[model samples]
Every structure is written in C-alpha cells, then in structure tokens.
Target: MKVRNDAYLKAFGENLKQLMAKSNKNAETVAALGGIETKQVYRVINGEHSATLSIVYAIAKGLEVHPKELFDFTFQE
Candidate 1:
C-alpha cells in the first residue's frame, strides 16, 4: 500500500538530495553510512518510496543534523 503522507516523503527526499549534494556525498556512501543499500537511497532520492523512522534517523545522523530539521520548513507570513 502507498503511504498516506506522500508529501512528507517527497519533501524529505528533496531535502536529503540537497543535503547529499551539499556534503559532496554519493548515494553509495550515504547508504553505507546509513546501513542501507544504494538502491534504497535511490528510491528515497527519487521519491518513489517512503522512508521509515529508522532510515530517517540514520540519514539525520549521517548528515549530522537533527531529525526534526528535516521537517522544518517555514512559511511566509
């Protein structure tokens, strides 16, 4: 079944992609750090699959950022 919160996954994927680019890291490296497969990283980056809490935490730890930061998007007043 598809995830109900697809937008969250999409946003998270975009943020992860940006973070990876900023860190000059590739999918293989990130996946290794996260203990996940490169194909899983590709799926997350492509927004074709949803990330579990464990994966999210791993990514946050790998990126050296708080997991909450991944969901922090401000709106203009």
Candidate 2:
C-alpha cells in the first residue's frame, strides 16, 4: 500500500533534503553516519515513513546539527 505523506512528514523530508544538499551528503552517507540503513533514510526523505525520536537523533547526529534544526521548517500540522 502506498503510504500517505502527511504535511509534517513532507516538511521534515524537505528540510532533510535541504540539509543534505548543503552538507554534500546523500542517503547512503547519512545512513552510515546515523547507523541506520540507507533504505531507512530514503523512506524518511520520501515521506514514506515517520522516523522515531531515536532515528531523528541519529539523523541529527549524522548531520552534525542539533535535532531542533531538523524540525525548523514551518508546517501547518
């Protein structure tokens, strides 16, 4: 089944993509750095899955940024 991409997830994914671009990183690199599967990174980036708090922390760690920055995007929900 195709997963629904909520506004929040979409916004988060966009923010992640932007950060990845800025840092010259990709899903594989982020996954390695975050200690997650590359597919997991893609799923989050594609808005196909909602990451857990731990995953968010891992992603932030991978990006070398504060977790709050990942959720800095404006969203209605």
Clashes of each: 0, 0
Off by over 4 Å in 2: 1-5
Candidate 2, 1-77: lDDT as tens digits: 22334877888999999999998998888889999888888888988789999999888888888999899888665
RMSD of each: 3.8, 3.1
lDDT agreement of model 1 with the native: 0.75
Candidate 1's residue-wise lDDT over 1-77, tens digit each? 24445666677678788888888888888878878778888888787878788877777766667888666753222
Each prediction's TM-score versus the true structure:
0.73, 0.88
lDDT of model 1, residue 61:
69
Instruction: Indicate the residue-level lDDT of 45 in model 2.
Output: 90
Most TM-score-accurate candidate: 2
Give residue 72's lDDT in candidate 1 (0 to 100).
70
Worst 10 residues of 1 by lDDT: 68-77
